[model samples]
Target: MLQRCKTLIVAIIALIFSQQALADTAWDSYKSRFLMPDGRIVDTGNKSVSHTEGQGFAMMMAVANDDRASFEKMWNWTRKTLQNPENGLFYWRYNPVEAQPITDKNNATDGDTFIAWALLKAGNKWQNPDYLKESDAIAKALVAHNVVRFAGLQVMLPGAKGFNLNSYVNLNPSYFIFPAWQDFADRSHLTVWRDLINDGQKLLGKMHFGNPQLPSDWVSLYSDGRTVPAKQWPARFSYDAIRVPLYVYWFNHNSPELQAYKTWWGRYPRDKTPAWVNVTTGDTASYMMDGGLLAVRDLVLQPANVAAPQITAQEDYYSASLKMLVALAAR
Candidate 1:
């Protein structure tokens, strides 16, 4: 019995090491494909532009892979290039081809949250105080600029501005980012993070629409606690809302919020699952999801089936990034 127990322990250790090795190889491949020499991570599918979302994702990836040098390189470039002088928060997008790349000064709340969350993880993992300080600053600025009271709920706007109206506020349900909110609450002991997490989850449970009864990419919350898909955008659960499940699953594997997605995705064949479904009209994406969405689906339904992050031929930036994210959360 003792010998058999020893053999089982050794096998478990070997499996862990093997999984990490696979992850490291995937990280290297991601760096080669998208990370620029100067630390900018290009969105290869979108005019080769860079954005805070990609940078944050890469920073988290670096920390997960234990690539300290890459993390610092990316952080330095991001600070120098994207940080707004008037505010500590980061600007959203950067287009290299534009003569004036940083024309838009709007701060994306999701990007800010991701950066702060990744920095916190890096700080704790690597015992770096500077990262922690900067992370707190970003989180503070994020709360100052975007977090707001709406419809009797503490919700985060999709950006620093342009979403708040007199009677209603626009929200991206995908930006709930539950796991990161939990980290912030744990690290800072801020009741605001806790409030956001609780209210955000409840809001999500109420935002389902159309025949599919899935949350849309964007929703409008009125003063009376009414929620509906925002009219300005397509009323479909597409690129952005897809991550809702990924983040929720990260926070709670047994969360009831995942049932709608599970039911919807389960109705379609694996390859034939449409990328988005209009919650109002029951419309669906013309084409199926890329490898990333599939990875997210498996992560929600069967984590054991999620493959390691690999660059599928012709996969775009968002697809590749989400695939990496799923792998990170699975481990």
Candidate 2:
């Protein structure tokens, strides 16, 4: 009996240590592969360019891993490099090779939300008022510049500029980062965030297209109350839209909104999952869905055994980020 008890204790201790190692490895691998020593996070798939989205993702991941040093480094870089002095919003992208790196000063609302959300989480975790203050500033900026009333509902613009075409406003349903909006609503004491959340869900429900009925990366909301896939962009459920279900599941695993995505994705065998789908044409990319996307799919659909796939060295910045996010969500 004594020997059996000792063996059981050893096994438990090993399991705990193994779990800790796995957690550490995920963030470490991400930093080594994607994050530069000076703090910029490279989107390896996007010509190694750095974007506000990647920076926000890094900050959030760093905070999740409880790596204060990395979090501060990334935040400082963002404030120095991306933050627009005229407005608190961050620039959408930075091309390092250019003499003027910040050519496009417009802000991506999703990126802004991610940065604000990270700051808020960091503030709460570290008990730092400064982080909270910065987060509030970003949240206010988003409200001032990005939120708009369309078709009798408040919605987030994909960017601070260029989205409002003459007859309609273009919206990206994935830009509605549900968890971030919820946090901002609670912390900033702003009812707009709550209203945005409700309107966002309504918009998402109406945005579904194609045979499987999934939202596209881009959609148009017209003054006449029509919603359709944006003609300017590909009418497909691809990279950007893949994040919809992930965010929804993160905010509320039991969300009714996730059912359509779950049902659509369930039609394919796990190994045969397509990288993307052209909703209108009934066409799909030849490549299979990467492990990272598959990891998120599993989390959203099969929550009980939420096992994030192991992060491999070959995975690029986005995939690695997804894997880390899954690991964080699982915890």
Candidate 3:
């Protein structure tokens, strides 16, 4: 009888654990803390106004919850902050209240690209001309500024300026090329799609290196398409680079290269390791929340051509990750 009772208790305990795992308690906590007073999705720094990424994520969440106010707040904020008339490209960062660029240089084309994507969705959902127009302008700027053709790789760079063929190539910025190109193909019906895919494949092919076999944030490129060592590359992979797989999977679902990459990341997976990961070695280096989300994302879903093994999502990680997942999934 004692043995039987012990077995029953074990079963009950397992059931309880499972229930806790799938519980909505974490979701509730996230909803309360992350969302804004007006029901818009917000970053923790509520004192400052919203950002394009935060607004975009908020829009996704709002759409998920059927929250009209949240959606409007996001859409309005994005349209105002991202659109720039002088350069015809979206500014990378801006103050919410004043709607002015925060920094001198535009950070990455991907920021605008993602904003364009969210805006495009908003346009579709509400049939808004303003959203469509802004999205098109950002797409135009991304293509205009970033495109450069080398012997083998036709890719996008961090900013539109020097056509340095001998410069080192990083998969981090290159990953944005696909998303921007996809958006361009979608909006303008251009013939750049083939070039975009080729560029992506070539870059992905070049990312693999080293004894333990890890990819770096950047790679040295020769005019002859020979990959070389450029010590100028950063040691860590930011949140931006980590999303390479996410973007790739979203665009080319069936690419073998992406599939292989995903499998590779899955093999040596460590989602909770550190905020900043070494792009070259896949080593955990630093710890910041923004970069932390990138690793956390791999646990839930990865892009094509990147591999990441799933790990037990910790309580804190799960709470943070699930909220982002919910936001993204809702879109």
lDDT of 1 by residue, 226-325 (tens): 9999999999899999999999999998899999998999998888999889999998889997688999988987887876778755877888899999
lDDT of 3 by residue, 140-221 (tens): 6766777667656677666554335454443343345464466568678866656766666676666555432334555556
Candidates ranked by TM-score, best first?
Answer: 1, 2, 3
Per-model TM-score versus the true fold: 0.96, 0.95, 0.65
Candidate 3's C-alpha runs over 4 A off are 1-52, 60-68, 95-101, 161-174, 177-180, 212-214, 227-230, 258-331
Of candidate 2, the 10-residue stretch with the lowest lDDT total is 302-311
* Cα lDDT of model 2 by residue, 44-131, tens digit: 8788999888898889988887999999999999999899988899999999988998898899988899999999999999999999
Give candidate 2's root-mean-square deviation (CA, Å): 1.6
Misplaced by over 4 Å in model 1 are 1-14
Which candidate tops lDDT? 1
How many backbone collisions does model 1 have? 1
